[model samples]
Structures are given as C-alpha cells and as structure tokens.
Target: MAQLLVTGGAGYIGSHLVLDLLLAGHDVVVVDDLSTGHHLALTRVAELAGRGCRFVHADIADVATVASALDGVDAVFHLAAFKLVTESMVAPERYFRNNVAGTAALLEAMVRAGVTRLVYSSSAAVYGPQPDAPISEDAQLNPESPYGVSKAQGETMLSWMCARRGWAATSLRYFNPVGTHHSGRIGQPQRDAAALAPRVLNALQHADQPLTVYGTDWPTPDGTCLRDYIHIADLNRAHLLALQVLLPGQHGIFNVGSGRPHSVREVLASCRRVTGREVPTTDGPRRDGDMARSTADASRFHAATGFIATGTLDDMLASAWTWAAHNPAGYAT
Candidate 1:
C-alpha cells in the first residue's frame, strides 16, 4: 500500500481525502497548522476510520516537519492554503507566502526526500473572468485576485519543480467545494469560512447574523454570480483517481467541478428548501476579485479518467445543511 501525506488534512476536503485513502488500505499522514482547520475533525476522522492515522501538527513550509513527514510518503495531496478570496485581497502577502512560497519549500523537501508524485488541490479561481460557459482546461488564466494569482503561480512553480526534480504531478483546479462526509463527523470545521455555503450555515445558527449575499449585481441569472459547487465526497474522489492513475513523468492540469453552474440565488433557494426556512440575507456589494460566472468543463479530465462530478447542487446544499444541523458551531460544538 502506498503511504501518502495530505498537507491540510485537518481541514475540510483534506480530512475527507485522508479517510478515503485509509479506507483504500493506504497509510496517510496529515500536516496542518490548524489556522483555519480544526484538530477535533482529525480526531473524529481517526475514530470513524477505526484506524490511527499519523498526524503532524505543523505547517507545510516547516523543513523539519516536511522532511520527517516525507520520510516514506509515496505521494502528497497538497491542500494547505489561504483560500478566501476576500482575505487574500486584504492580505496578498500572506497568501503568497503561505500558498506560493510555502509550496516551493515543500517541493524542495519532497525532492530531497525523493518523493515525487503529487496531486495538488488548486482552485478554479485561477481562471478569473471567462465567458458565461464551462471553463475548459485550456482557458486563459487571468486571475483577478491575489488568491487566484497565487494559485496560478503555484501551478507554474509545480511545473518547473517537476521538470527539474523529475516529479510527476496533477493539479486539479477545483470550483466551489461544499458538503460534508455522510457520517457528519468531519465537515467545514472552520467557523469563520468566507465561502458561500458555510456562511449560509453560520447565518442559520445565529438569528442576528444575516447571510451576506456578496455581489448580487454580477452579470448572471438574477444578477448574481454562477459557480460549480461540487460535494466534498466527489471532490476528494477525484484526488484519489488522479493519484491512482497518473503515471511517472505525466504532468497534468485538470479542473474538478460538477460542470453545472449554479447562481447565488439558486444556492440560496436550495438552502432555504433544505432547511424549510427563509435564510435571512442582506445584499452587499461585490467583494474585490470576485468573478461573475465560473464553471468547469472538466471534459479533458473526464475523458481521460471518466471522472464526472455526480453530485447535484441540491445534494450539496442538503449535505451542508446536514453538517451544520449536526454541528452548530463547527468543531467547536
């Protein structure tokens, strides 16, 4: 069985990936600084899997941690990053340092440790503004925010590193990822998530906390932005698929999305329908570096691996609501 390391394994999607790997009979190691991730979620993951997975409570850029963690890792799922677009806009340097520079250090350690295979958790934000259609793998990357720019630059850095170090890698440019594990034990453990779905859950928990519909004036159906919301289960599955199938010397970049774009209003409606209550929301202007419409074509990745996201928006909203209902204050509860 292969030994794997997940950079953000204490976080939402990475934790799911860890459990998936363990179930597949592989050894998994998680290294997370717990900035936005909850350590309790990792505890629940170990309990649910009924196996003790190795966890190093450290950052990806920590050389000692990276070297120690990379001791026997066959591959890595790099998911650690500062993901909020608005937060990245407010603090671009932090995003660059953590997401880009941190990634560089990790790659160097991987090369030194002779671990090559990697499946990077990238974002569709790398493709800033495209036509109101499915963004193919070849879409020009004009990232509008520092977060997107950092992701784009991360991909470039990976390319160069792979070339120099003879590493094989696949970068999955994911759209909006939502939902929780069916067990409801590990989910979006971050209480202050700026993403749309978690913010809706947060609003539901508190009566006075009105959901901020940021940028309702974007050019789309109902003047709101459109995004592809893939379930966490489906998204993590893609990582496994990439890891299993990618051959050495194969450098691939693919998009991980459902290929169906749902607008903000549509997601809100789904949340309301799932919760059976009107979600209190207040209209707010668009945050800097937000896109109008962005969805993944994913045909290249699908045709290559037959991996199409099967979760619907309704399923995403339902799973999110289930997680929120089960854990009101995230892992704090």
Candidate 2:
C-alpha cells in the first residue's frame, strides 16, 4: 500500500478521496487548515478508516508545516485552494497568494523530499467560456476570473517545475463537482453559505426560501446554463485511477467529468422530485463571467485509464439531497 498525502483532505472533495484511498488499502495523511472545511469531517474520516489515517491541522502555505507533513509520503493530492469565483473577484490577492504561491511552496517541499508523483486538483474555469460544445483538454485556455487565472497559472507552474526539476505531476481538470458519498457519512460541509445544491436543499427542507435562479436567458436548450456534474464518489474513483497511472516518469493533464450536460432547470426539477417539495425559484440577471454552457470532453482520461463516469444527474441530485437532509446547517453547528 502507498502512503498518500492529501492537502485539504478535510474538505468536501478531499475528504471523499481520502476515504476512497483508505478503502483501497493505502495509508493517508491529511493536512487541512479548516478555513472552509469542518474539523468534524476529519473526525468522520478517522472513524471510517479505523486509525490508519493521520490528520494534520495546518495551512498549506506554511513551508515548514507542509514539509513536515510530507515526510515518507509516496504521492501528494494537492486539493487546497480558495475556490470561489465571485469571492476571487472581490479578493484577487487572496487567490493569488494562497492558490499560486502556496502551490509553489508545496512543490518546492516535494522536490526537497524526493517525492515526485503528484495529482493536482484543477478546474474547468481554466477554459473560461469557449464558444463551442464539448470543450476538450486541448482547447485554448482563456480564464475570465481571478480564480481561473490562478488555476491556469498553477498548471503552468506545475508543467515548468516538472520539466526543470524532474517531478511527475498530473493536473486533473474538473468540471462541476457535486453530490456526496453514497454512504452519506461525509459531504460538502463548508462553513461559508455559498454552495448551490446543499443550500438550496437546506432552504427547501427547513425554511420556505425561494431558490433564486441566476439568469434564465442563456442560449441553451433550456435558457439556463448547462454544466457537467460529476458525483463525488465517481470523482474519487477517477483520482485513484490517476494515482495508478502516475509512474516514476509519466506526467500529463486530464479532465475528470461526466461529459454529459444538464441544465439548471433540470437539476432543480430533479431536486423537487427527490424531496417532494416545491422549490420556489425566481429568475435573476446573469452573473458576470457566466457561460451559457460548459461541458467537458473527458475521453482522454477514459482512454488512458478506462475510467468512465457511471453516475447520472438524478443520482447526483438525490445524493446531494440526502446529504442536505442529514446535515441541515452545513457544518455550522
């Protein structure tokens, strides 16, 4: 079994990946600052993994802290970042300093420790709004927000460092990551009140707040924006496949997504069906930098590793509703 170091493993995606790695018989060491993640989430991971896992409460930007956590680690899953497009616009410096500079520090530490294999958690925002359908991995990258710019810069730095320092890295660019673990033990427990499905389900289950639909005048079949949603469980499986593909001298980029597009109205309609409640939604002006459709052509990863996304949109929405029903306040309590 390999020893994996997961940065920000207490968060939504990170925690789910940790559980998957542990179940696959790999030892895990997680480093999280808990800025946006919950401490309770790590507690749940420990319970599920049965004491074979380690949790280090520290910031990824701290060189000494991260270096200490990297000792004897076989591979690193770098999932730590400030990931909010609107917030990044309001605070670009925070995004650059944390996402870009912090990644540089982690890479430097990996080089010093002779740990070369790394799987980076990248995003689809790097492609921005491509005026086409089914965006591929080789598309021209034109990031529109600070968050996207930071991710693009991070990918560039990873490529440059791999070439100059002989480190093997794989940047897995994700589309829209949603849903929860099928076990319903852990999920997206963000302290901030920004998540779409969780918050919408929470309002629908508890308060009768109207779910605001942002912009219904898009050029899609349903007028609302279309996005490719991947289940957290399926995403964890893809990460494991990536780890298996990362050899001593192999490095590349792959997009992890379902390759199928679903509109906002469809998702809301599914949520209403699952919860048996009228999810009231009102139309609003389009947010800046919003795209009409952003789906991925994830054939590269599938061709390389034979990993196909099997979860459907209904599965994603149902699992998200289950998680929301279990944790109503979203880690606030």
Candidate 3:
C-alpha cells in the first residue's frame, strides 16, 4: 500500500476521498487547516473506514508543518482551496493568496520533502461561459472569476513544476460535485454553503426559507444556468484512478464531470422528486462570474484512464437527500 498525504482531507470532497483511499488499503495522512473543513468529517471517515489516518491541523501554505506532514508520504493530493465564485469576485486577493501562493508553498514543501507525485483538485470554472455545450481540456481558459483563475494558475504552476522538477502531477478540473457517499457518514456542510445543491437541501430543511434560483434569463434551454454535475463518489473514484496512473516527468489535465448538462430548475425538480417535498425557489439576478453553461467533454481522460462518471441526476439527488436527512447539522450532530 502506498503512503499518501491529502492536503484538505476534512472538507466534503477531501473527506470522501480520504475514505476511499483508506478503504483501498492506503495509509493516509491528512493535513488540513480546518478553515472551511470540519474535524468531525475526518472522525467519521475513520469510523467508516474502520481505520484511522494521521491528521495534522495545519495549513498547506505552512511549509514547515506541511513538510513534516509529508514525512514518509509517497504522493500528495492537493484539494485545499477557496472555491466560492461570488466570494472570489469580491475578495480576489484572498483567492490568489490562498489558492495560488498557497499551492506554490505546498509544491515547495513537497520538493523539500522529496515527494513528487501530485493530484490537484481543479475546477470547471476555468472554462467560464462557453458557447459550446461540452468543453474539452484544449479549450481556452478564460476564467471569469478570480477563484477560477486561481485554479487555472495552480494548474499552470503544476505544469512548470512537472517540467522543471520532474514531478508527476495530474489536475482534475471538476464540474459541480453533488451527492454523498452511500453510507451517509459525510456530506456537504449546509451552513453558509455556496453551492446550489446544499443550499437547496438546506432550504428544504427550513420551511420558511426559499431557494434562490439565480438568473432565470440565462442563455439555456430552461433559462437557467446549465452545469455538469458529477456524483461525489464518482469524482473521488476518478482521483483514485488518476493517482494510480500518474507518471514521472509528466503532467495530465482532465475534466471530471457527468458530461451532461442540468439546469438549476432541473436540479430543484430532482430534489423534489427525491425528497417528495416542495422546493420553494425565488428568482434572483445572476451573481458575478456565474456561467451560462459549462459541461465537460472528458473523452481524453476516458481514453487515457477509462474512467467515466456513472451517477445520474436522480441518483445524485437521492444520495444527497439521504445524507441531508441523516446529518441535519452536518457533523455537528
């Protein structure tokens, strides 16, 4: 079994990925700042995996701390970043400092510790509003928000690092990650969630609050934003596959998505079908950096690794509903 270090192993995706790695019989050491992550999620991961992983409560930018965490590690999965588009528009500096500078620091720490393998958690926002339905990796990266730019910048840094330092790095440009594990042990934290799925689910929990459908006049079939939503399980599995196939002196960038577009209204409808409850929504103006349509043509990744996202919209909603129903306060309970 390989020894791995996940930089953000307590967040929604990180927690799930750590669980998968542990179940796959890898020794994992998670280093997270707990800025947007929960310690409880790691606790639950340990419980579900029937094994415990080492946790270092520190930031990835902390070179000394992260270097120490990298001791005896084989590779690193970098998933620690600020991901809110709206927030990034208002506070671009924070996104650059944390996502870009922080990534540079992490890479430096990796070099110091002599662990070269890396799997970066990138985002679909790098594509921005594309006229095309599904965008490929070769598409021009005109990121609309600072958050997207930061992710793209992280990928750029990885490419240079791979070329100069002989690091094997893979960047997975993720689409909207929905759903939860089948066990319902961990899921998105509902409080202050920026994503539509968790916000919609949180609205369902609170009968008085209505889910806000941002920008009903977008250039889409349903007049709402179209997104490529992938199940959390499928996304994590892709990470595992990417980790296994990483090669030295090479850098790979792939889009990880369901390769299908679903509108905001469609997602709400699916939530209703899964929960058998009314999803009250109010129309709102589009937030800055919001995309009209962003799907993924992940054929390249499929050709290279044979990994395809296998979760339908209904399946994603059902798994999310199960997790929300089980963990109302999201690890607080």
Strongest candidate by TM-score = 3
Question: RMSD (Cα, Å) of candidate 1?
Answer: 1.7
**By the lDDT metric, which is better: model 2 or model 3?**
3
lDDT of 1 by residue, 143-206 (tens): 9889999999889988876677667899999888998887778888546567889888787777
Candidate closer to the true structure by TM-score (higher is better), 1 or 2? 2
lDDT of each: 0.85, 0.84, 0.91
TM-score for candidate 1, please give it.
0.95
Q: List residue ranges in candidate 3 displaced over 4 A.
A: none
* Cα shift from native, residue 310, model 3 (Å): 0.7
- For candidate 1, give the lDDT: 0.85
Q: Give the TM-score of each candidate.
A: 0.95, 0.95, 0.96
lDDT per residue, candidate 2, 1-333, as tens digits?
Answer: 999999988888998888889888999999889888877887777788785478888888788878888999999999999998889989999999999998998888787777888999999989998988699989999999899999999899888877776778888999888888776678875333455676567557655667677799998888998989888878998998888777554568899999998888988888878778877777889987788888989999999999899888778878877777777666664
> In model 2, what lDDT does residue 55 have?
86
Say what the RMSD of model 3 is: 1.4
Q: Please provide, for model 3 over 15-54, each residue's C-alpha lDDT reduced to its tens digit, 9 standing for 90 to 100.
A: 9999999999999999999999999999889999999899
What are the RMSDs of all candidates, in order? 1.7, 1.6, 1.4
